[model samples]
Target chain A: MSLSLNQWTTRRWSVAEAVDGCVRHGLQAVGLWRQNVAEQGLAESVKLVREAGLRVSSLCRGGFLTTGSAESLDDNRRAVDEAAELEAACLVLVVGGLPGVTPGEPLGSFSRDLGGARERVAESLAVLAPYAGERGVKLAIEPLHPMYCADRAVVSTLGQALDIAERLPAEQVGVVVDTFHVWWDPQVFEQIARAGERVFSYQVCDYLHPLPADVLLGRGMMGDGVIDFAPITRAVLAAGYAGDVEVEIFNADVWAADPDEVVATMKERYASVCGF
Target chain B: MSLSLNQWTTRRWSVAEAVDGCVRHGLQAVGLWRQNVAEQGLAESVKLVREAGLRVSSLCRGGFLTTGSAESLDDNRRAVDEAAELEAACLVLVVGGLPGVTPGEPLGSFSRDLGGARERVAESLAVLAPYAGERGVKLAIEPLHPMYCADRAVVSTLGQALDIAERLPAEQVGVVVDTFHVWWDPQVFEQIARAGERVFSYQVCDYLHPLPADVLLGRGMMGDGVIDFAPITRAVLAAGYAGDVEVEIFNADVWAADPDEVVATMKERYASVCGF
Candidate 1:
């Protein structure tokens, strides 16, 4: 039940700072974000985390295939290369939403083709899966919350992500089970059991109520929201996910807190509340 | 293909005003909320709509069964009585979210028993369905969006709603297929087809992105957001739903506009974009 601190939980911290924070907190693993890795340079980030003796549990993201854009696919290939270079557990994918809708744009000017967007994700995976396998990286498709289906990932359920994953090479493609996104799902437990051995990463966070203005940042620290983590954590363990559980909160208040305090709280909550 | 205007679409309008607006717009049906019926006095509100030649498409809501409280059961009984008196096509049920979590409370202080809350909804339905059945009122379960799963409705998918609905008498219990709440569901079409004759109401609205500060009011007028209404509308129709399609927008901008103008836009959208 090793705890992994996802960098986004302490959003202001650099890769070097996150690595140091993990070491200071006696955490054995840290999840890396592409933005943070780029800031410190990928080679330098790898060296820093390795020297600090922290396992790279997962890479933040690498999918937006809904656009069917050449650039998106090319970028995903680069992300796979990065994940391989860092020797991370998996490259977590936040597949894109609708094709034409940018945030804050007039609502009328967007595609109404959700089916088309989802189809592209499956097709893009066919291309990325083997490439990732060749580089010894697993592409973990993360099913985001349905609230994000419009502006973020079209993959909105563990079952839906698994449906796509089962069609590809098992060693190359799988799903990330994030509690905050899939906790509300009626079929969650069944899906988790079905995702056995295909569970590439297990991410934890609580789904807070009275969601903030930006729902994207609505995740709260465990025990600070309505989610029951024990049952879900046990389900993930039952699914044979013998990997680090990453705590990935996207709260504005959390981002503003001292990174050290955040990591400390995460560790305490993980041990006490999350049934490891 | 007949269109119905849900009262909340014109939040500022009185029952009398809503009835008149429906009549003036050549709309034959109007959905009534309990608050508005109470505001105008139930008998008077019924008389007003009946005299205006407007059919009562459905009562706005009648379920908060998750609390398992005697008071909630009593209130639902009264709501059923109100719908029976008005001769609504059905009484829409927005089954309650988690118990004991008021909006804006400290995030840490809330129940984590989603399964228990949902069970209470089923148990309450067993009590209410027979009561509504004797009164010739159908209990229509409305599965709201997963985003609202914490504070609004725990029933967040058409399939989940059907699972509950199937346990009761088919003629007495059914489900409302609301576009805004269910459009993001990958299994929407399959669930809609399975809903079949159990489809009590067909609610239409667009799910706007860059959701407003209050996600509750983030609905948009048809064609103003990313929803493709034609396919969903067709699925409902194909499933043997022959009821009036209710235009139920909960947008702040729409609320602030002139009620008459809002009705006009609703009519135009229902005709052109909704594929009714």
Candidate 2:
């Protein structure tokens, strides 16, 4: 396995630039976000990466099932199509949060219906899994940190993600083991083991507290935060997951740096900690 | 069951003032913090609450076992003694996080030896449990939010806390069901049932994101955040927790308010949602 530069790590870079940066860093793959693909035109983005001989490790995201909205489902279907078109490893699903919330929305708007929202995720997965499977695209449920449980993703644990995924076939639905989201969990390794072959993607990033005003962008570059990546990487490898290790940081400082410099830092950090 | 106004909610208020505030709000109990108790002189703090006809629901905190330091054990024993002296229901334990780590410590300083830290907590508990029981105090393990798992507490779930608690007698070691900490857990309701009579304390505080710089003080007043209190309160009650429902907000705004007003808000908030 080799390092895959997740495009969000350098938020400013275009798909074309990100693929070029991956090439420059000798990275074998690049994880593309849907937004960047859209900005460059999907077919052109696919052509650019394919022509550069860079594999699409995974697609950034495709789930917000809690809204119970038609738009969310339609958007997800389009994301699945994009993943299939790009021949990405899987379509990563953030799996939506509380139905009525927007980021920084007032407390009054919070439904506090966590279980209801979770049920919607399972229901939505039931609907989307078959579609993705038919298109030969895997839906990788990324269980984000519990801090994002309210407004970002209701699926807050890999165990919980697997519980949903196990309902569908392993090839159709799987879990993303993102170090930043799960490093705090006491049962993380156990859950990682339990995920087994259903482990679809392995994303790396570090977690730093005293988080900035936008908590979403608080992911630190690997080796810049407390996560011991060696152990987590070892666990994923032990669980029989042989895939690209995508560095998916969302820090503002990292994003502000030159794209080439960002990729260089990611490569250095990834090599130092992940041993891939 | 009635409400207990946790002293940290009105952080600036002295123990004497807090007891008076609780009384003014028609509250029968106040959860005392060790620092506040120490500031007032422990004996004097005990007398103040007793004289005001206020029961000491629980002591604020008593665990930092992750340090694997002798001082941590000594401090926890002291906390047990203090709880016993006040005849508090239980000594709330925020069982510490990773060893050799300080808040905002460099990422390199983090041991990521979570298992080792957790082992130390169990070892520390084994040492302190008998002492606490002998002193007529119950040590309540309060599993904090997972976000704090890195630098604050390794015990991040009620199931994990209960796993530790079950190793000892129920009367000697019980679990705290704090809504803010355990609400996001998918198995929380099941764990609450498993806790049964071992539920020594049930703390209530709402959770809101866009947390302040110090995430520690981000707890919102009940009814002001996203937690559905009624269900959690109901779960604890069903688990045979016939104790005070402590309102333990830690917001800077709440602390900045007049003690009387803060207590008033807590009472109103508790009554509106906690069903006590």
Which candidate comes out best when scored by TM-score? 1
Every model's Cα RMSD, please? 1.3, 1.5
Local distance difference test, candidate 2: 0.87
Per-residue lDDT of candidate 2, residues B1-276 (tens digit): 888889888888899888888878888999999988999999899889889988899998899998668899999888998999999999999888777666655544457667888988988899899999899999999999998888788999999999999999899998999899998998899999999988999888988765666777769988776778888888898898899888888888887888788787777767778783
True contacts kept of each: 0.70, 0.49
lDDT of 1 by residue, B1-276 (tens): 589999999989989999998989899999999999999999999899889988999998888889889999999999999999999999999998898776555555557899999999999999989999999999999999998888879999999999999999999999999999999999999999999999999999998877888888889999877788899999999999999999898888999999999999988888899884
Candidate 2: list runs displaced more than 4 Å. Answer: A108-110, B104-110
TM-score of 1: 0.98
Candidate 1 wrongly placed segments (more than 4 Å)? A104-109, B104-109
User: DockQ for each candidate?
Assistant: 0.68, 0.60
**Docking verdict class for candidate 2:** medium
Model 1 achieves a DockQ score of 0.68
Over the stretch A1-276, how does candidate 1's per-residue lDDT look in tens digits? 689999999999999999999999899999999989999999999999889989999998899899778899999999999999999999999998898777565555567789999999999999889999999999999999998898889999998999999999889999999999999999999999999989999999998887888888889999878788888998999988899999999999998998889998998888888874
